[model samples]
Target: MNKQFIVNLPVRQLDKSKAFFSALGFSFKAEFTNENAAFMIVVEDCIYAMLTTEPFFQSLTGKPVARATEANEVVLCLSCESREEVDSLIAKAAAAGARIPHPAEDHGFMYDQGFEDIDGHLWNLVWTESQA
Candidate 1:
């Protein structure tokens, strides 16, 4: 069986975040699409918990969402088959409206970059030496 994983993210604007990931070629699973949130399919192995602002998500967690710049709660790491793939996704994310996390860095054995979604969620795109 294919084990499924889900990551819930608090978003100020559901539609905006949905559109952003959509631009990056991700599609929502219709069954999980709703007014409060949209389930974004990152890949067969991953899913995003794209939550709406206010009562929708707040009521569930009973707390404020973490600011990406202020916290290091978690960084979602995803693998790529090659360095070019990591580079491509970073470019695509910038075009899709995500704030670039940092300049691309290399460590001889790995390459990586990232961006913050509208909701302050961090996605780490990586390409390892094995992939290179």
Candidate 2:
């Protein structure tokens, strides 16, 4: 059986968030979209970024949403093919107006970079020897 994953994130404006991610090369599954949320496909792994309004998200969890800018409860990590691939993606994100966390890390064994999406959702794009 194939496994699938969907990471739900709270957004202030669904349309804006959808556009932002679309610019980053993620396409939405219209069948899973609604006024309250959208299911954006990240890769063929059945990964979906479920963007829901803040109010609707709050309904799912009573606790206050962690400001993804200050800190993130979840770090959406993805593996890349090479160090160059990692660098290219980070550069593209910066061009898209995303903020890169200071102090990029690189060791022989691993390479990882962090960025904050427009709505402050943190995503970690990483590449490791094994993944490469």
Candidate 3:
């Protein structure tokens, strides 16, 4: 069965968040995006990230959103085809105002790194060797 997934994140500024992600080579679905939220297409039609305004997101959850900068929330990870791709993407993210929390790590079969976006959302980029 085919399934679609969406991860919602609250951002203080919609346009700023959109620009940040766009600089990192992400595209948003115009049909689902508007003034209050942007539907970021992470993986074709299967995976997506909804960047929403604080008030709009709050209305959906009916609770106070977690302060991503001060609290440990979700860590969204994306897989890359190679170590170079992982490093390249991290560089783009940094150039787009993302904060690098640490250096990349090489663990034999995997190489990984992480960055916090403009909204303080943590994201991990990883490249893993495929076993034959």
Candidate 4:
């Protein structure tokens, strides 16, 4: 059987968040999406990101949602097929209103870059020589 992975994040504005990710070339699963949450398809059916309203998220976790802008919450890393793919994804993220925290890094064997989304969530895109 194929394994699936999911990550949940809190967002202030569901519509805007969906729009932002949509602009970055992501699609949502309608069956798992609604007014309070959006199931973002990160890698077809294998990987998903559940973007939930802050209130809904708080209800689920019964804790204060992290202020990702001012504090560190989590850093999500995704693997890419090539260095150019990483750069390309970053460009799309920038155009979609995400913040590019820093420039890409090359470590001979690894290349990586990251961006902060509209809700201040950090997403790292990485590529490795071994992946090629």
Candidate 5:
């Protein structure tokens, strides 16, 4: 059996969320995009993030959407090819209005940095050395 991962996140506005992620070099699937939500293609068809309006998201989950600014949800992490790539991606996110929540940490074998998106979703960019 084949399986894929799709993360659902609530956004106050679809267009704004689309733009924010686009600026960070993400693209959406036109077939899954509508006025209320967008299927952000995180890694082609293997991974995706469904950015949906609060009301729509709430309906699907049968619960009130958590105010991203006031509550902790889940942190999304992405692997990068190199430490430079991690820094570069975080820099782009920051330039696109994301807030850097903390400084980048270098642990000799791994480097990690974090940023909060426009909707207050925390994302960690990491680059790790291959074990010998």
Candidate 6:
């Protein structure tokens, strides 16, 4: 069986959040986008992130949305094709107003870097090499 993964996140402003990810080269599905939420396509049809306005998100969950800056909820990680891709993405993110929380780490076969988006969501870009 085939399955798709969708992660939902609460954002203070839908348009701002959309622009942030767009600057990183991610596109949205028009059928799934609206004023209250934007469906960001992470990997074709397999992976997607729903960036919903805080109020809209709260309406669905009936709970308070966690302030990503003040608390840790989830860290969204994406695999990169190469170390250069990882660095390039980080640069784009930073240029788009993301904050680099820490320096990139090189662990022999693996390299990774992290950034906080406009809404303070943590995201990590990683590249791994097979040691065969």
- TM-scores for every candidate against the unseen true structure: 0.86, 0.86, 0.97, 0.95, 0.95, 0.97
Winner by TM-score between candidate 4 and candidate 1: 4
For model 6, residues 1-132, the per-residue Cα lDDT tens digits are: 469999999999899889999999999999989999999999996999999999999999899899999998999999999999999999999999999999999997999999999999999999999761
Tell me the tens digit of each residue's lDDT in model 5 across 1-132: 457899999999889889989988999999989998999998875889999999999999798889878888989998889999898889889999899999999999999999999999899999999991
Q: What is the C-alpha RMSD of each candidate to the true structure, in Å?
A: 2.2, 2.0, 1.2, 1.3, 1.2, 1.1
Give per-residue CA lDDT, model 4, range 1-132, as digits (tens): 689999999999999999999988899999999999999999986999999999999999899999899898889999999999999999999998999999999998999999999999999999998745
Between candidates 1 and 5, the lDDT winner: 5
Q: How big is the positional error of residue 45 in model 5, measured in Å on the Cα after superposition?
A: 2.7
Task: Give stretches of model 6 more than 4 Å off.
Answer: none
Positional deviation of 60 in candidate 6, in angstroms?
0.6
In model 5, where do residues sit more than 4 Å from their true spots? Answer: none
- Score candidate 5 by TM-score against the native: 0.95
lDDT of 1 by residue, 1-132 (tens): 677787777677788888888887788888878888888887766445555654677788888766665787688898888889998888888998888969988998998998887666788998887645
Which parts of model 4 are misplaced by more than 4 Å?
none
Error of 6 at 105 (Å): 0.3
Q: How close is candidate 4 to the true structure, as a TM-score?
A: 0.95
- TM-score preference between candidates 1 and 5, better one: 5
lDDT of 3 by residue, 1-132 (tens): 579999999999999999999998999999999999999999996999999999999999899999999997989999999999999999999999999999999998999999999989999999999981
Kindly list the per-residue Cα lDDT of model 2 for residues 3-105, writing each as its tens digit: 9998999998899888878767778989989999999898876677899998889999997877777775777888778888778778877778788877569
The CA lDDT of each predicted structure is: 0.79, 0.83, 0.94, 0.94, 0.91, 0.94
**Candidate 3: misplaced stretches above 4 Å?**
none
> Candidate 5's C-alpha lDDT?
0.91
Is candidate 2 or 3 superior in TM-score?
A: 3
